[model samples]
Target chain A: MGQYKITLSGEAQTAIVRHGEQAFPFECCGFLYGHENDGRFVTEAMPVANNKKGDRRKQFEISPPDYMKAEKYALGNGLQLLGAYHSHPNHPAIASAHDLALAMPYFSYVIVSVKNGKAADIKSWRLKETIEKKFAEEKVAVKHMAMFSD
Target chain B: MAKIIIPTPLRKFTANTATFETSGSNIKEAIQELTGAYNGLTRHLLDNDFNIRSFIKIYLGEDDINSLQKEDTTIANDSVISIVPIIAGGC
Candidate 1:
């Protein structure tokens, strides 16, 4: 197991929570960005609705057209995608079995789990095979199963 | 017996079951078995050469298959595999 940290601004957190609530019965997803060397992630894009399943777990996906837009934006600004964020409504704010399988090595996965029908918990994860890793939440640190990148 | 957890997006391919258990020695064999049973999903999860699709992500426990052993990653009876597709959108 490895550790990862996901650092994002307060405004980002508020937007993520609000988007999660808006997509109550399905999952919502979006992107987080910050300076390459900086620690704070700023929520940039708007949240998208999951057209796949109507489940409460928001699954964020960029469409082809949107991907082109995001790519242009990143190229123009020299900012790469830092990571992704989603919500697990009515479930624990941990990586689901589906999450671990599809994880990218360099990106962070942020999950906000709603409790009692409310967004009550937030967590982050980074997948590592056997190597030790560190994730930044508010600051950088290394420990057991800690998450990095937001 | 390794169990595969299907993501919500792919549930339509699996008849809406969240998890499936099969006997296989490694991740590749397990996924092959799954796609065989699921029909058209093979194209969605893998390319003609069996590499994972760019839009999809696969993980075993806390370790991503790309960082671990790819399709050759061993699957034990107790292991759980997760499949999550990348989502893109803004609020």
Candidate 2:
């Protein structure tokens, strides 16, 4: 809503990388959940299935059931669903045209770049407009969250 | 009456209210009541033929409408309906 940036927990960062690497030769995707602190938001990774059905390397589809399950999980842990994450194998960490279409307002999108079964880079983005034509990059800060066992 | 939980994306049309109540015997009527009460929400909630937008997922408590009774899904006095947009997107 204002000048907000994304904060990824150390665990989340590790999970994103691990998930991307594990799904190598295919795309991996998941959700991010957290709360806002002084206009900045910190979130953790909730890796859902990449259930994209066809061409797993090029596309990923997280069904509504997966989303609901994630939401329930977040609620149980006292976190909110803040955004989503996906991996682009053999590609850069950039949101594609199709990604823009599937995006709704008010959620961050974290994209991971995986090369040769290893994670190369990770970036976060948000749709800048209601009828968006593109995604604007957001600052992603990795921080250690002192919390109970995950 | 049933409680319909509105997700973030559609809050603008409801004056940014996160949840509201609608009267109906089933999910379809409950949604219709929601649209009737929120004039600006119809476009986002329905298509040209007035069907629930396919991307919108309606859940009655823990059961999805599709696996339940679909539009005919029953609604009791305390049903908590969640209207969530599918967030899956990539290519």
Candidate 3:
């Protein structure tokens, strides 16, 4: 299997962290839109409401309708739906058992740790193709764009 | 024939093909034709009882099948169907 990695644009990173902070005490979820070249390049982060019912502090759900919409949006913008990102309120930025159970191959799972209503650590993971169904951490590269005045 | 759009995550099971054509009359039959062509998709899309998995969602155009008659939802020749997996998880 090839090594997997994802690069997030500065704006995309800010959008993800902000969404996590805004949804403090609960999990926030969204989709990552980008294209695959040498590796995945995330240019946009589109936040979607967590549709999971009942207790949502430790879980988040992205309805199929929402995913459909995200796909359409990405296609319209000439990009691909690379994967999804979600926040872990008051928890570490790690994939839990629940995450591994629902994970699919080829999609990067980004987890953000939110501490006291603030965004902390962030990591990305991908499911291994083995029968054991395990996740391996993917290298994350954040591009900080410089504001230039011309 | 109706067109079934396979999401990226599930494309490996479909030989990396993004869309499939089926002549089934309804959603159930369409899926039957799909899984028939791609045996690897059977376990991922359906359970032991041959029911659509809870995490798998089928949409006809922009509307979810659950909003319609579900498996019985009929499809037109030009209809476009989408198979989207539920995105859910936490820490």
Which window of ten consecutive residues has the lowest lDDT sum in model 3 chain B? B7-16
* Candidate 2 per-residue C-alpha lDDT over A11-98 given as tens digits, one digit per residue, 9 for 90 to 100: 8888888898898888889888888657545557878888776888899888877876776776688877778889999999888887
Candidate 2 wrong stretches, greater than 4 Å: A1-4, A132-134, A144-150, B8-18, B36-43, B67-69, B72-74
lDDT of 1 by residue, A15-99 (tens): 7777776776556776665544545355453464454443334454544334334434655676555567787877776676566
For candidate 1, the lDDT comes to 0.62
Better of 1 and 3 by TM-score: 3
Q: How many residue pairs clash in each candidate?
A: 33, 0, 0
TM-score of the first chain alone, every candidate: 0.71, 0.88, 0.93
User: Which CAPRI tier for candidate 3?
Assistant: medium
Query: Clashing residue pairs, candidate 2?
Result: none
Q: What is the per-residue lDDT of model 3 for residues A5-87, given as tens digits with 9 covering 90 to 100?
A: 88999888888898998999999999999988777999999899999997789999998888888878876899988899999
Considering only the true interface residues, what is the Cα RMSD of candidate 2 after superposition? 1.9
Candidate number that wins on DockQ, 1 or 2 = 2
Cα lDDT computed for each candidate against the true fold: 0.62, 0.80, 0.90
Lowest lDDT 10-residue stretch of candidate 1 chain A: A139-148
How far in Å is the alpha carbon of B28 misplaced in model 2?
Answer: 3.0
